[model samples]
Target: MARGKPDLAALETRIGRDFADKALLRWALTHVSAAAQRPDSYERLEFLGDRVLGLAVAHMLFEAFPDDSEGELSRRLAALVRKETCAEVAELWGVGPYIRLGEGEAQTGGRKKRAILGDICEAIIGAAFLDGGAAAAEAIVRAAFGPKMHEAGRSLRDAKTALQEWAQARRLAPPRYRLASRSGPDHAPSFELAVEIEGFEPAVGAGSSKRAAEQAAAAAFMAREGVTE
Candidate 1:
Protein backbone atom coordinates (compact mmCIF):
# COMPACT_ATOMS: atom_id res chain seq x y z
CA MET A 1 0.00 0.00 0.00
CA ALA A 2 1.12 3.56 -0.59
CA ARG A 3 2.17 5.55 2.46
CA GLY A 4 -1.04 7.60 2.84
CA LYS A 5 -3.34 5.32 0.83
CA PRO A 6 -5.91 3.26 2.67
CA ASP A 7 -5.18 -0.35 3.50
CA LEU A 8 -6.35 -2.04 0.31
CA ALA A 9 -6.41 -5.48 1.86
CA ALA A 10 -8.58 -4.34 4.72
CA LEU A 11 -10.89 -2.49 2.40
CA GLU A 12 -11.18 -5.57 0.24
CA THR A 13 -12.09 -7.59 3.31
CA ARG A 14 -14.81 -5.13 4.23
CA ILE A 15 -16.34 -4.99 0.69
CA GLY A 16 -15.85 -8.73 0.09
CA ARG A 17 -13.67 -8.37 -3.03
CA ASP A 18 -10.01 -8.17 -3.83
CA PHE A 19 -8.94 -5.89 -6.62
CA ALA A 20 -6.67 -7.35 -9.27
CA ASP A 21 -5.70 -3.82 -10.22
CA LYS A 22 -4.54 -2.04 -7.10
CA ALA A 23 -4.27 1.18 -9.05
CA LEU A 24 -8.01 1.19 -9.71
CA LEU A 25 -8.72 0.81 -6.04
CA ARG A 26 -6.47 3.74 -5.26
CA TRP A 27 -8.13 5.80 -7.99
CA ALA A 28 -11.52 5.00 -6.55
CA LEU A 29 -10.59 6.48 -3.18
CA THR A 30 -9.12 9.64 -4.65
CA HIS A 31 -11.31 12.69 -4.25
CA VAL A 32 -11.50 15.43 -6.87
CA SER A 33 -9.80 17.88 -4.55
CA ALA A 34 -6.92 15.46 -4.21
CA ALA A 35 -6.99 14.81 -7.96
CA ALA A 36 -6.66 18.50 -8.66
CA GLN A 37 -2.96 18.02 -8.09
CA ARG A 38 -2.70 14.45 -9.35
CA PRO A 39 -3.25 12.70 -12.64
CA ASP A 40 -6.28 10.63 -11.53
CA SER A 41 -9.26 10.75 -9.21
CA TYR A 42 -12.49 8.95 -8.38
CA GLU A 43 -14.82 11.01 -10.55
CA ARG A 44 -14.63 8.77 -13.60
CA LEU A 45 -14.93 5.72 -11.45
CA GLU A 46 -17.87 7.27 -9.65
CA PHE A 47 -19.64 7.85 -12.96
CA LEU A 48 -19.24 4.22 -13.95
CA GLY A 49 -20.17 3.04 -10.47
CA ASP A 50 -23.36 5.10 -10.52
CA ARG A 51 -24.57 3.17 -13.54
CA VAL A 52 -23.41 -0.14 -12.14
CA LEU A 53 -25.19 0.52 -8.87
CA GLY A 54 -28.40 1.43 -10.65
CA LEU A 55 -28.31 -1.73 -12.71
CA ALA A 56 -27.53 -3.92 -9.74
CA VAL A 57 -30.22 -2.35 -7.59
CA ALA A 58 -32.76 -2.47 -10.38
CA HIS A 59 -32.11 -6.16 -10.89
CA MET A 60 -32.38 -6.84 -7.17
CA LEU A 61 -35.65 -4.94 -6.88
CA PHE A 62 -37.04 -6.70 -9.92
CA GLU A 63 -36.38 -10.13 -8.48
CA ALA A 64 -37.25 -9.20 -4.92
CA PHE A 65 -40.57 -7.59 -5.73
CA PRO A 66 -42.19 -9.50 -8.53
CA ASP A 67 -45.59 -7.98 -7.73
CA ASP A 68 -44.46 -4.36 -7.61
CA SER A 69 -45.35 -2.00 -10.43
CA GLU A 70 -42.73 -0.04 -12.37
CA GLY A 71 -43.54 3.16 -10.51
CA GLU A 72 -43.16 1.48 -7.13
CA LEU A 73 -39.86 -0.12 -8.11
CA SER A 74 -38.56 3.21 -9.35
CA ARG A 75 -39.46 4.91 -6.09
CA ARG A 76 -37.62 2.27 -4.10
CA LEU A 77 -34.65 2.41 -6.46
CA ALA A 78 -34.45 6.19 -6.19
CA ALA A 79 -34.55 6.03 -2.41
CA LEU A 80 -31.91 3.34 -2.28
CA VAL A 81 -29.54 5.08 -4.71
CA ARG A 82 -29.77 8.57 -3.24
CA LYS A 83 -26.61 10.16 -1.84
CA GLU A 84 -27.77 9.80 1.76
CA THR A 85 -28.32 6.09 1.32
CA CYS A 86 -24.96 5.67 -0.42
CA ALA A 87 -23.28 7.58 2.41
CA GLU A 88 -24.96 5.28 4.87
CA VAL A 89 -23.55 2.29 3.01
CA ALA A 90 -20.07 3.88 2.91
CA GLU A 91 -20.20 4.52 6.63
CA LEU A 92 -21.28 0.92 7.19
CA TRP A 93 -18.24 -0.29 5.23
CA GLY A 94 -15.94 2.17 7.09
CA VAL A 95 -15.08 3.92 3.82
CA GLY A 96 -14.59 7.30 5.46
CA PRO A 97 -11.23 6.36 6.87
CA TYR A 98 -10.00 5.12 3.50
CA ILE A 99 -10.88 8.12 1.36
CA ARG A 100 -8.00 10.30 0.09
CA LEU A 101 -8.88 13.94 0.56
CA GLY A 102 -6.93 17.14 0.05
CA GLU A 103 -5.48 18.93 3.04
CA GLY A 104 -8.20 21.61 3.10
CA GLU A 105 -11.01 19.10 2.60
CA ALA A 106 -9.60 16.85 5.29
CA GLN A 107 -9.51 19.73 7.75
CA THR A 108 -13.13 20.63 6.89
CA GLY A 109 -14.44 17.15 7.65
CA GLY A 110 -14.71 15.98 4.02
CA ARG A 111 -14.61 12.41 5.15
CA LYS A 112 -17.94 12.82 6.84
CA LYS A 113 -19.56 14.90 4.15
CA ARG A 114 -22.40 12.97 2.59
CA ALA A 115 -21.50 13.94 -0.96
CA ILE A 116 -17.87 12.82 -0.70
CA LEU A 117 -18.72 9.63 1.11
CA GLY A 118 -21.45 8.78 -1.35
CA ASP A 119 -19.25 9.53 -4.35
CA ILE A 120 -16.50 7.43 -2.92
CA CYS A 121 -18.91 4.55 -2.42
CA GLU A 122 -19.87 4.69 -6.05
CA ALA A 123 -16.29 5.06 -7.17
CA ILE A 124 -15.34 1.95 -5.26
CA ILE A 125 -18.08 0.06 -7.00
CA GLY A 126 -16.79 1.37 -10.30
CA ALA A 127 -13.32 0.27 -9.47
CA ALA A 128 -14.59 -3.17 -8.56
CA PHE A 129 -16.31 -3.39 -11.90
CA LEU A 130 -13.17 -2.49 -13.78
CA ASP A 131 -10.92 -4.69 -11.71
CA GLY A 132 -13.07 -7.80 -11.58
CA GLY A 133 -15.91 -7.14 -14.02
CA ALA A 134 -19.67 -7.05 -13.39
CA ALA A 135 -19.76 -10.01 -11.05
CA ALA A 136 -17.42 -8.31 -8.62
CA ALA A 137 -19.32 -5.03 -8.72
CA GLU A 138 -22.68 -6.76 -8.33
CA ALA A 139 -21.43 -8.69 -5.35
CA ILE A 140 -20.32 -5.50 -3.63
CA VAL A 141 -23.59 -3.71 -4.37
CA ARG A 142 -25.69 -6.61 -3.15
CA ALA A 143 -23.71 -6.83 0.06
CA ALA A 144 -23.82 -3.14 0.74
CA PHE A 145 -27.34 -2.26 -0.45
CA GLY A 146 -29.43 -5.43 -0.35
CA PRO A 147 -30.95 -4.87 3.07
CA LYS A 148 -31.67 -1.20 2.43
CA MET A 149 -33.30 -2.12 -0.87
CA HIS A 150 -35.65 -4.46 0.96
CA GLU A 151 -36.59 -1.89 3.58
CA ALA A 152 -37.00 0.94 1.09
CA GLY A 153 -39.21 -1.22 -1.04
CA ARG A 154 -41.49 -1.71 1.90
CA SER A 155 -41.74 2.00 2.71
CA LEU A 156 -39.92 4.78 0.88
CA ARG A 157 -41.11 8.16 -0.27
CA ASP A 158 -39.13 11.20 -1.30
CA ALA A 159 -39.35 13.96 1.27
CA LYS A 160 -40.98 16.36 -1.16
CA THR A 161 -43.70 13.89 -2.05
CA ALA A 162 -44.31 13.01 1.57
CA LEU A 163 -44.51 16.67 2.57
CA GLN A 164 -46.95 17.46 -0.22
CA GLU A 165 -49.17 14.61 0.80
CA TRP A 166 -49.12 15.76 4.40
CA ALA A 167 -50.11 19.28 3.41
CA GLN A 168 -52.87 18.01 1.16
CA ALA A 169 -54.32 15.84 3.93
CA ARG A 170 -54.66 18.94 6.04
CA ARG A 171 -56.02 20.98 3.06
CA LEU A 172 -52.93 23.19 3.09
CA ALA A 173 -51.12 24.48 0.07
CA PRO A 174 -48.33 22.36 -1.32
CA PRO A 175 -44.87 23.21 -0.13
CA ARG A 176 -42.80 25.64 -2.17
CA TYR A 177 -39.05 25.50 -2.75
CA ARG A 178 -36.70 28.33 -3.62
CA LEU A 179 -32.98 28.35 -4.29
CA ALA A 180 -31.57 30.49 -1.51
CA SER A 181 -27.90 30.42 -2.51
CA ARG A 182 -25.25 28.62 -4.52
CA SER A 183 -21.48 28.52 -3.91
CA GLY A 184 -18.26 26.64 -4.55
CA PRO A 185 -16.61 25.70 -7.85
CA ASP A 186 -18.55 24.88 -10.99
CA HIS A 187 -17.56 21.22 -10.84
CA ALA A 188 -18.59 20.79 -7.22
CA PRO A 189 -20.90 23.65 -6.29
CA SER A 190 -23.02 23.67 -3.15
CA PHE A 191 -26.65 24.64 -3.15
CA GLU A 192 -28.81 26.02 -0.39
CA LEU A 193 -32.56 25.91 -0.68
CA ALA A 194 -35.49 27.00 1.43
CA VAL A 195 -38.70 25.02 1.62
CA GLU A 196 -41.90 26.57 2.90
CA ILE A 197 -45.37 25.38 3.67
CA GLU A 198 -48.27 27.65 4.37
CA GLY A 199 -48.59 28.75 7.98
CA PHE A 200 -45.20 27.40 9.00
CA GLU A 201 -41.67 28.72 9.12
CA PRO A 202 -39.49 27.86 6.20
CA ALA A 203 -36.51 25.53 6.65
CA VAL A 204 -33.21 25.71 4.78
CA GLY A 205 -30.96 22.87 3.65
CA ALA A 206 -27.74 22.60 1.71
CA GLY A 207 -26.43 19.95 -0.66
CA SER A 208 -24.45 19.42 -3.84
CA SER A 209 -27.42 20.18 -6.06
CA LYS A 210 -30.63 22.18 -6.00
CA ARG A 211 -32.84 19.10 -5.84
CA ALA A 212 -30.82 17.56 -3.04
CA ALA A 213 -30.97 20.80 -1.08
CA GLU A 214 -34.71 20.96 -1.63
CA GLN A 215 -35.11 17.41 -0.42
CA ALA A 216 -33.00 18.13 2.65
CA ALA A 217 -35.07 21.22 3.44
CA ALA A 218 -38.26 19.24 2.95
CA ALA A 219 -36.99 16.48 5.19
CA ALA A 220 -36.13 19.00 7.88
CA PHE A 221 -39.56 20.54 7.57
CA MET A 222 -41.22 17.16 7.78
CA ALA A 223 -39.24 16.28 10.87
CA ARG A 224 -40.24 19.51 12.55
CA GLU A 225 -43.90 18.81 11.74
CA GLY A 226 -43.60 15.24 13.03
CA VAL A 227 -44.28 13.56 9.72
CA THR A 228 -43.14 9.97 9.44
CA GLU A 229 -43.67 7.20 6.95
Candidate 2:
Protein backbone atom coordinates (compact mmCIF):
# COMPACT_ATOMS: atom_id res chain seq x y z
CA MET A 1 0.00 0.00 0.00
CA ALA A 2 1.08 3.56 -0.63
CA ARG A 3 0.99 6.48 1.85
CA GLY A 4 -2.65 7.52 1.32
CA LYS A 5 -5.48 5.45 -0.01
CA PRO A 6 -7.41 6.82 -3.00
CA ASP A 7 -11.14 7.36 -2.81
CA LEU A 8 -12.08 4.33 -4.85
CA ALA A 9 -15.77 4.79 -4.10
CA ALA A 10 -15.72 8.28 -5.55
CA LEU A 11 -13.90 6.95 -8.59
CA GLU A 12 -16.61 4.33 -9.04
CA THR A 13 -19.20 7.06 -8.88
CA ARG A 14 -17.40 9.07 -11.53
CA ILE A 15 -17.22 6.08 -13.84
CA GLY A 16 -20.85 5.16 -13.16
CA ARG A 17 -20.00 1.69 -11.96
CA ASP A 18 -19.05 -0.03 -8.73
CA PHE A 19 -16.33 -2.63 -8.36
CA ALA A 20 -17.37 -6.07 -7.24
CA ASP A 21 -13.85 -6.64 -6.00
CA LYS A 22 -12.52 -3.40 -4.58
CA ALA A 23 -9.01 -4.87 -4.52
CA LEU A 24 -8.93 -4.65 -8.31
CA LEU A 25 -9.54 -0.92 -8.14
CA ARG A 26 -6.78 -0.53 -5.58
CA TRP A 27 -4.37 -2.56 -7.67
CA ALA A 28 -5.25 -0.51 -10.73
CA LEU A 29 -4.09 2.68 -9.03
CA THR A 30 -0.88 1.08 -7.73
CA HIS A 31 2.08 1.98 -9.88
CA VAL A 32 5.07 -0.29 -10.12
CA SER A 33 7.11 2.32 -8.28
CA ALA A 34 4.67 2.10 -5.41
CA ALA A 35 4.35 -1.69 -5.52
CA ALA A 36 7.98 -2.72 -5.90
CA GLN A 37 7.72 -4.61 -2.67
CA ARG A 38 4.25 -5.97 -3.27
CA PRO A 39 3.14 -8.61 -5.76
CA ASP A 40 0.28 -6.44 -7.01
CA SER A 41 0.71 -3.47 -9.35
CA TYR A 42 -0.98 -1.91 -12.36
CA GLU A 43 1.42 -3.33 -14.94
CA ARG A 44 -0.46 -6.58 -15.45
CA LEU A 45 -3.75 -4.75 -15.42
CA GLU A 46 -2.47 -2.22 -17.94
CA PHE A 47 -1.50 -5.03 -20.31
CA LEU A 48 -4.92 -6.61 -20.12
CA GLY A 49 -6.66 -3.28 -20.29
CA ASP A 50 -4.77 -2.32 -23.44
CA ARG A 51 -6.25 -5.30 -25.22
CA VAL A 52 -9.69 -4.61 -23.88
CA LEU A 53 -9.50 -0.98 -24.95
CA GLY A 54 -8.33 -2.00 -28.39
CA LEU A 55 -11.25 -4.33 -28.88
CA ALA A 56 -13.77 -1.80 -27.69
CA VAL A 57 -12.32 1.01 -29.78
CA ALA A 58 -12.06 -1.16 -32.83
CA HIS A 59 -15.64 -2.18 -32.56
CA MET A 60 -16.76 1.38 -32.02
CA LEU A 61 -14.89 2.61 -35.06
CA PHE A 62 -16.16 -0.22 -37.17
CA GLU A 63 -19.72 0.62 -36.29
CA ALA A 64 -19.34 4.38 -36.32
CA PHE A 65 -17.76 4.68 -39.75
CA PRO A 66 -19.31 2.26 -42.14
CA ASP A 67 -17.81 4.05 -45.15
CA ASP A 68 -14.28 4.48 -43.89
CA SER A 69 -11.55 2.33 -45.34
CA GLU A 70 -9.60 -0.09 -43.15
CA GLY A 71 -6.51 2.12 -43.22
CA GLU A 72 -8.50 5.19 -42.19
CA LEU A 73 -10.09 3.32 -39.31
CA SER A 74 -6.67 2.15 -38.19
CA ARG A 75 -5.35 5.71 -38.17
CA ARG A 76 -8.27 6.78 -36.00
CA LEU A 77 -7.67 3.85 -33.71
CA ALA A 78 -4.00 4.73 -33.34
CA ALA A 79 -4.86 8.33 -32.59
CA LEU A 80 -7.45 7.32 -30.01
CA VAL A 81 -5.28 4.80 -28.18
CA ARG A 82 -2.09 6.83 -28.07
CA LYS A 83 -0.62 7.73 -24.68
CA GLU A 84 -1.63 11.36 -25.10
CA THR A 85 -5.27 10.52 -25.70
CA CYS A 86 -5.36 8.11 -22.78
CA ALA A 87 -3.89 10.77 -20.53
CA GLU A 88 -6.56 13.18 -21.70
CA VAL A 89 -9.26 10.69 -20.75
CA ALA A 90 -7.59 10.02 -17.43
CA GLU A 91 -7.52 13.68 -16.67
CA LEU A 92 -11.18 13.93 -17.59
CA TRP A 93 -12.01 11.25 -15.02
CA GLY A 94 -9.75 12.87 -12.43
CA VAL A 95 -7.63 9.75 -12.28
CA GLY A 96 -4.46 11.58 -11.27
CA PRO A 97 -5.48 12.21 -7.68
CA TYR A 98 -6.37 8.56 -7.21
CA ILE A 99 -3.07 7.16 -8.50
CA ARG A 100 -0.71 5.66 -5.92
CA LEU A 101 2.88 6.51 -6.66
CA GLY A 102 6.09 5.83 -4.76
CA GLU A 103 7.44 8.68 -2.70
CA GLY A 104 10.16 9.52 -5.19
CA GLU A 105 7.78 9.50 -8.13
CA ALA A 106 5.26 11.64 -6.29
CA GLN A 107 8.00 14.14 -5.42
CA THR A 108 8.96 14.32 -9.08
CA GLY A 109 5.43 15.12 -10.33
CA GLY A 110 4.47 11.59 -11.28
CA ARG A 111 0.77 12.31 -10.93
CA LYS A 112 0.85 14.79 -13.80
CA LYS A 113 3.05 12.71 -16.10
CA ARG A 114 1.24 11.51 -19.21
CA ALA A 115 2.67 8.02 -19.13
CA ILE A 116 1.76 7.38 -15.52
CA LEU A 117 -1.75 8.76 -15.90
CA GLY A 118 -2.32 6.83 -19.12
CA ASP A 119 -1.12 3.56 -17.63
CA ILE A 120 -3.35 3.98 -14.60
CA CYS A 121 -6.30 4.76 -16.86
CA GLU A 122 -5.77 1.49 -18.68
CA ALA A 123 -5.28 -0.33 -15.42
CA ILE A 124 -8.58 1.04 -14.19
CA ILE A 125 -10.26 -0.22 -17.34
CA GLY A 126 -8.65 -3.60 -16.77
CA ALA A 127 -9.91 -3.61 -13.22
CA ALA A 128 -13.39 -2.80 -14.47
CA PHE A 129 -13.21 -5.69 -16.88
CA LEU A 130 -12.00 -8.13 -14.26
CA ASP A 131 -14.51 -7.04 -11.66
CA GLY A 132 -17.52 -6.92 -13.89
CA GLY A 133 -16.56 -8.52 -17.25
CA ALA A 134 -16.24 -7.11 -20.79
CA ALA A 135 -19.49 -5.20 -20.58
CA ALA A 136 -18.17 -3.16 -17.71
CA ALA A 137 -14.97 -2.36 -19.54
CA GLU A 138 -16.78 -1.49 -22.75
CA ALA A 139 -19.19 0.80 -20.97
CA ILE A 140 -16.37 2.74 -19.37
CA VAL A 141 -14.42 2.97 -22.59
CA ARG A 142 -17.44 4.08 -24.56
CA ALA A 143 -18.38 6.69 -22.01
CA ALA A 144 -14.87 8.05 -21.66
CA PHE A 145 -13.69 7.90 -25.27
CA GLY A 146 -16.83 8.11 -27.34
CA PRO A 147 -16.62 11.83 -27.96
CA LYS A 148 -12.92 11.59 -28.70
CA MET A 149 -13.56 8.93 -31.30
CA HIS A 150 -16.13 11.10 -32.99
CA GLU A 151 -13.83 14.09 -32.99
CA ALA A 152 -10.88 12.12 -34.30
CA GLY A 153 -12.95 10.62 -37.03
CA ARG A 154 -13.90 14.12 -38.19
CA SER A 155 -10.40 15.60 -38.19
CA LEU A 156 -7.17 14.34 -36.58
CA ARG A 157 -3.61 14.66 -37.78
CA ASP A 158 -0.47 13.11 -36.42
CA ALA A 159 1.64 15.42 -34.28
CA LYS A 160 4.59 15.38 -36.67
CA THR A 161 2.46 16.31 -39.66
CA ALA A 162 0.69 19.05 -37.77
CA LEU A 163 3.95 20.53 -36.54
CA GLN A 164 5.42 20.56 -40.01
CA GLU A 165 2.41 22.33 -41.41
CA TRP A 166 2.55 24.91 -38.64
CA ALA A 167 6.16 25.69 -39.48
CA GLN A 168 5.55 25.82 -43.22
CA ALA A 169 2.65 28.25 -42.88
CA ARG A 170 4.85 30.67 -40.96
CA ARG A 171 7.71 30.29 -43.52
CA LEU A 172 9.97 28.95 -40.82
CA ALA A 173 12.46 26.17 -41.32
CA PRO A 174 11.21 22.69 -40.71
CA PRO A 175 11.65 21.53 -37.13
CA ARG A 176 14.74 19.46 -36.41
CA TYR A 177 14.50 16.37 -34.26
CA ARG A 178 17.34 14.60 -32.50
CA LEU A 179 17.61 11.58 -30.30
CA ALA A 180 18.01 12.77 -26.70
CA SER A 181 18.56 9.40 -24.98
CA ARG A 182 17.50 5.79 -24.71
CA SER A 183 16.74 3.73 -21.62
CA GLY A 184 14.92 0.63 -20.35
CA PRO A 185 15.56 -2.93 -21.60
CA ASP A 186 16.22 -3.93 -25.19
CA HIS A 187 13.03 -5.94 -25.20
CA ALA A 188 11.07 -2.80 -24.34
CA PRO A 189 13.19 0.25 -24.78
CA SER A 190 12.17 3.87 -24.18
CA PHE A 191 13.33 6.66 -26.46
CA GLU A 192 13.65 10.36 -25.74
CA LEU A 193 13.65 12.90 -28.54
CA ALA A 194 14.31 16.59 -28.74
CA VAL A 195 12.67 18.85 -31.29
CA GLU A 196 14.13 22.24 -32.11
CA ILE A 197 12.79 25.10 -34.18
CA GLU A 198 14.90 28.03 -35.28
CA GLY A 199 13.70 30.68 -32.83
CA PHE A 200 12.28 28.68 -29.95
CA GLU A 201 13.62 26.59 -27.11
CA PRO A 202 13.86 22.84 -27.67
CA ALA A 203 11.27 20.45 -26.26
CA VAL A 204 11.79 16.82 -25.38
CA GLY A 205 9.46 13.83 -25.37
CA ALA A 206 9.67 10.09 -24.74
CA GLY A 207 7.92 7.01 -26.11
CA SER A 208 8.33 3.34 -26.90
CA SER A 209 9.55 3.92 -30.46
CA LYS A 210 11.65 6.52 -32.22
CA ARG A 211 8.75 7.67 -34.38
CA ALA A 212 6.48 7.77 -31.38
CA ALA A 213 9.08 9.79 -29.53
CA GLU A 214 9.36 12.20 -32.44
CA GLN A 215 5.60 12.61 -32.52
CA ALA A 216 5.60 13.25 -28.81
CA ALA A 217 8.38 15.78 -29.17
CA ALA A 218 6.56 17.52 -31.97
CA ALA A 219 3.42 17.62 -29.82
CA ALA A 220 5.39 19.13 -26.96
CA PHE A 221 6.77 21.80 -29.24
CA MET A 222 3.31 22.56 -30.55
CA ALA A 223 1.96 22.94 -27.05
CA ARG A 224 4.86 25.16 -26.04
CA GLU A 225 4.32 27.35 -29.08
CA GLY A 226 0.56 27.43 -28.63
CA VAL A 227 0.02 25.85 -32.02
CA THR A 228 -3.03 23.64 -32.22
CA GLU A 229 -4.27 21.45 -35.02
The top-ranked prediction according to TM-score is 1
Whole-model lDDT, model 1 = 0.85
- Model 2, TM vs. native: 0.74
In candidate 1, which residue pairs get closer than 3 Å at backbone N, Cα or C atoms, i.e. clash? none
| lDDT, residue 86, model 1 | 88
- All-Cα superposition RMSD per candidate: 3.0, 5.5
State the C-alpha lDDT per candidate. Answer: 0.85, 0.84
Distance from true position, residue 145, model 2, in Å?
Answer: 0.5
Model 1: per-residue lDDT, tens digit, 124-214? 9999999989988999999989988756344577788788888899999989999899997654678999998879999998897787899
